[model samples]
Target: NLRFNKVVICTDADVDGYQIRTLVLTMLYRLTPTLINKGYVYIAESPLYEINTKNKTYFAYTEPEKTDILRRIDGEKYTIQRSKGLGENDPEMMWLTTMSPESRRLIKVLPTDAERTAEVFDLLLGDNLQGRKDHIAEHGAEYLDDLDVS
Candidate 1:
């Protein structure tokens, strides 16, 4: 057994990513609420931007936000960078964006209706292929962009 000081879930900002994150959070909350309450788990803010400044650093979630933040800062002395994914960053950056509690963003898991959650989990991860297919087909249109046809 490994002793973990914290558990950080890093996922993409897509529907699939959201679903995976939700599933994990649900599992953790149900299985180990103490860990959650103790602040042992976090959801890393996958940087939408990698901004550098002389006095302060920032991570913006949108291009307009990045522009706004940049404008508010001393542009002459600051450098702005954008990160497409966590993989683009090095170990230190990853640690700064995800591992460091002070600088990172943590998403708390909330309790949900057990019956609905069970039904959803079963439909998504169950052994029944047709059930999964039907569930996907029903809600698939809304999240088509998340699917990789290839």
Candidate 2:
């Protein structure tokens, strides 16, 4: 019995992250679509913001960007907040990072390819463990990253 008024999925910005988010969205769409129709589910954009200044904040999209930001902000005192995962944060942080409309980025849930999406959800989150394992084994290698291991 899911009583959530809004389901905010804050996953990483990688392939696995995308797959997980898709699976959850699919389950909700199948089981309780009213919530989705009412604009309840959201995909929270986990920040890649590294160098935050008083004037403007920057999000590092890649290692090169991170290096560039560091170089640009050299000798300037700025707060660096390294957010590893959403689980490391508390409810307040979650609200601030993912829930707040003013400060957070949320993507509306929309069904693109319903049939393929249904099959994906079934393979990923269904009762069959072997199906889940095989699915991951086949597609997971593409998204495997060292930073995503946590």
Could you say which candidate leads in TM-score?
1
List, residue by residue over 1-150, the lDDT tens digit for candidate 2: 557666787787656777787777777778877667777777888755556788766666456777889899888777776655666668876676666788788777655543367777777767999989988888887866654456
Which digits, one per residue and each the tens of the lDDT, describe model 1 over residues 1-150?
Answer: 329876777886545666777787778766876766666776765767868776677887667978888788843577766565666668887788776768777664334433355567877887989999988888889977657778
| Residue 24, candidate 2: C-alpha displacement in angstroms | 2.1
Q: Which residue runs of candidate 2 sit more than 4 Å off their true CA positions?
A: 1-6, 12-20, 52-82, 90-95, 113-116, 123-150
Off by over 4 Å in 1: 1-6, 11-40, 52-57, 62-88, 113-119, 148-150
Model 2 whole-model lDDT (C-alpha atoms): 0.72
lDDT of 2 at 38: 72
State the displacement of the C-alpha of residue 58, model 2, in Å, after optimal TM-score superposition.
4.7
**Each model's Cα RMSD:** 4.8, 5.4
lDDT of each model, Cα atoms only? Answer: 0.71, 0.72
